[model samples]
Target: MSDGWEDSADAWVASQGEEGDFGRRWVMDAPMLERVRRRPYVRALDVGCGEGRFCRMLAGEGIAAVGIDPTVALIDHARRLDPGGDYRVEAAEAIGFDGGAFDLVISYLSLIDIPDVATAIREMTRVLAPGGTLLIANLAGYNSAADAHGLGWVTLADGRRVHAMDDYLEERTAWIEWRGIRIRNWHRPLGAYMTPLLEQGLTLTHFAEPPAHGGDPARQALYNRAPWFLLMEWQKPRAGSSSGPTGRA
Candidate 1:
């Protein structure tokens, strides 16, 4: 069977438009761009770059970016949208690039779609140059865990909305459908993401749970009840005697 993204590529692209969906536009992009702007990276790779939106944003910031996705249709749409941009049909678990090829690598809301998170993380790290940065934006573990199990918030007698979570420690795949798009996302605990990076010797440098933007007061308050997205930055250590496989980490 085809990955659901291939079937939903056009709709997905249409939904993202020039900026991105709401969570990306309001919650994620600004902080991500800010982090990237602080450094002077010449080359960047966007893993699972749906429709190349983030790649285009990177180009706008004067960084040369190459976007890769497993879905052929999404890549075609991305290429069509940016004619001159570099977009490829590739999977994150097996990135076809030389080691230490990029000064920065970004995985924006794509880790959830990948089945083999550990392998993908390793591949992403392998292509990062010494001291290069790896930035990731993902659904918060609490939100994903609750959603995967069909759990949602409940309004208490005091009018506080509370979300009760269970099965958070388990790792599994769940299907989600929105606006004629259907896709599967993997749900894993926070440690499932952090442990592998630490094991691979990448150092976590920064983390954030940026508040929701652009929504009304009530909607914004609803989103602010819990973080919808989690942003993390990890860096390969500078070249030295203690550096690991990809020169740094």
Candidate 2:
């Protein structure tokens, strides 16, 4: 959990002011919020909640949410920005909560940052109540794979630029440097994520590669070809629950 994130905390906070970076502002915000509103949750937990942005969003709507992150500096920012909010410095892999304590658990753009995604998923699932939902926003596997080797967008002989992928089946790590921020991210194939979730007995209730909105038209068109993000709602079935699994949206 401690992979030198404290160094990048300041730059990250500055980068994600109020609206967030390009991805959150345009591609993810609307869709993620819309899906969160579909169900009511008495208690919610946001794992890997850097600066607690989404937790604050839920709080604005009168929903109480607890935000957790391992990085001390980021947690400080969260507490400083929203003094009355609940923000804890805790790792996703070792969340400090009882089993079935939260009705809603969210991992927003955090799977990539987490070094141990499997352990984190297990912990999140453990803390989730039956009939609860685990809402996630993440970098699509295709996008992650494409950037694995740092040789993105190769030019073809016919002058067409296409994203190139390598070592897709293997987990990869790379440092993302942007706007004075430098942080490490892990990339795993689509199956690497799905297999663990399925084994944990969670049902895929909804999935989608939603489109971007209110952004530059050219960038939006580019993302349409290969989505930069993905949304998934995984539900744990209640006892004797006859409700069946739902597919991709």
**What TM-score would every model get versus the actual structure?**
0.92, 0.91
- Predicted model with the maximum lDDT: 1
- Total clashes for model 2: 0
lDDT of 1 by residue, 1-249 (tens): 555998898889888889787788878999999999999999999999999999999999999999999999999998999999999999999999999999999999999999889999999999999899999999988888875433357778999878766698999888877877888888889999998887778988999998987756776776788767899999987677344554433
Model 2 Cα shift for residue 247 (angstroms): 20
lDDT of 2 at 115: 81
* Candidates' C-alpha lDDT: 0.88, 0.85
Alpha-carbon error at 88 in model 2, in Å?
Answer: 0.5
Q: Which pairs of residues clash in candidate 1, taking residues 3 or more apart in a chain or in different chains?
A: none
lDDT, candidate 1, equals 0.88
lDDT of 2 by residue, 1-249 (tens): 446689989998999997888788889988988888897777899999999898989887667899999999999999999999999999999999998999999999999988878899999989999889999999987787776444256789999988877777888888767677778888888887897787677899899998877689887877777767899999977766644344211
